[model samples]
Target: MTTLTRPLLVTLVDDYDVVLTGLAHMFDDYRDRILVSEIDANAVLHDAIDIVLYDSFAQPESDHEEIAELVANPQARHVVVYTWNFQPELVQAALDEGVHGYLSKTLPAKELVEALEAVAAGEVVVIEPKRRAASAAGLDWPGRREGITDRESEILALITQGKSNAEVATLTYLSPNTVKSYIRSVYRKIGAESRTQAVLWGVGHGFTPDHHRIDHWLGGP
Candidate 1:
């Protein structure tokens, strides 16, 4: 593991306790590169922190206000969104909101730490341009039900893509409780009793990826 002369003090902001715990474990191996000081969904900092890492598993746009709030906090000198949803417009919006970095969740742990270190040193970072471009092209879920809200549709799309509630919370910038509520609503609307059933229903109703774009999005040769 690579070590930094001064490890960045990082606080993770996510809606799920399990997600926070998992991230803490991932960073624990690189003690010399980064220190996981605090984890909370509200971006509260008990002590001075060098970096605030916001994990967006699926909902980047929805979390803009929270990101802006964290950026305005004096304790957060650097704010980065570590996300799987790489819509270019959303990334640009985050930058506009004063985010220091927007990085892909696909990045290896070491690379993520390095990105945080760079952000702490007063640099703006964005990883995986091609993926962001492909994402910007969009991942649409057709055949939506009549009453589902846009946010519900977005969460349903991610659910069909096989994301857990915790993952969904991270992606959508929603609290896990919020994610669960959305899921329940989606289930009632679609008549799904379980995740597997929802996924099956989504597939039957056109919750599918554009294969051509997916190939490019995954960096396939």
Candidate 2:
């Protein structure tokens, strides 16, 4: 007798219903490799899902907290971000938030399935390594080489934008607690004791809006 394994169950999440529907169709031919079990902005998994793919379209930075929440979901074993934006900072931020895979939207349907399968098998996959490398090379913040991560720099830049913690939470989709934690880490790295001082340090160290284009990419006001 031979044992037959079940297909990997997947959930597709996106703000747009059209995107969810399209993704479901894209995976139709890969029924053996994976099953599109659920498709909705708020995907409620009735059963355990092997992978939860979050489509960011063009706004990857704004979805970080959502990705973190999905990764922490009880029903989600693996979480992947499917996006057209391959900005290194966004990719690094997603990975730091526990996203299992970062795949380009331009990937062929078959390749996307394979990447998801790899993620389901406990592998971290990221397409567009060249772009990621280029983005990383451009991260020359004053404290970046001193151990501050890409995520920290992003939060610092947000602070410089005069965004309150709650506003930051809304923009970054992170909880207040998580935003505060990141703030603490940023403060420690830059040796700032207050938000005002941190903002000053960020301004003085080149963590400015001109350098951090997250707002532009995310279409923020």
Candidate 3:
């Protein structure tokens, strides 16, 4: 009988030789079922690379941007950020820039592997709650868009605008309580917990802050 391989290609991009070595060992320990590649940021794009787990500190901004654009291509399945001292907007920026998902170095390696496998299967491994909050934060809605109502869409628009609940209420002339309700629905739809994550979720689903869009919110533009 032939052995069917696990349909995932994993890449490790880190500047620290020690970290890379340790990651290599961990991947190797996983029965080699996962194909692991140790790569520098300069490496050319390869269709076989399904997920890229890269270090934020190792590469320069230019190189990182190049890598991000490359990962944005259809060929690269996902790119997970692994580093400390990440700014609030880093993950959302990555999603906007076209990467798949974000993970911190502090998370367990096994969960990271699972996330990679999930992304490889063409399913987004989400990290936020957006649907619930979206409805609560009523801002203003666009003409036509996703299945959500115009009012719900407006909340999303305000969310993408980086407006807090209080801000949304003030801008839309809605009670803060109503704004909070819309935000909760938004969170439920986007699977985002925090406002930043909801913004990212909005971006991830192509739901611009145009008073419209859907999906479990990850990040936004």
TM-score of each: 0.59, 0.55, 0.48
Worst 10 residues of 2 by lDDT: 211-220
lDDT of 3 by residue, 45-109 (tens): 55456677775432332235655655755655677665432444555666677676665444445
Stretches of candidate 1 exceeding 4 Å from the true structure: 1-4, 58-60, 129-221
Q: Arrange candidates by lDDT, descending.
A: 1, 2, 3
Every candidate's lDDT: 0.67, 0.66, 0.55
Task: Mark the regions of model 2 whose C-alpha exceeds 4 Å error after superposition.
Answer: 1-4, 39-44, 58-60, 129-221
| Model 2 per-residue lDDT tens digits across residues 1-221 | 21227677777675433334556677667777676654444445566777888866323366466777788888788899876556567788888888889987667678887788788777899985433222221113335565776456556767887888988776666689988999999889888899999989877875553311111111111
Better of 1 and 2 by lDDT: 1
lDDT of 3: 0.55
Clashing pairs in 2: none
Task: Give the candidate number with the greatest TM-score.
Answer: 1
State in Å the error of residue 188, model 3: 48
Candidate 3 TM-score, true structure as reference: 0.48
| lDDT by residue (tens digit), candidate 1, 31-75 | 766767545445355566788888653333555777888888887
**Cα lDDT for residue 35, candidate 1:** 65
Q: Candidate 3: RMSD over Cα atoms?
A: 16.4
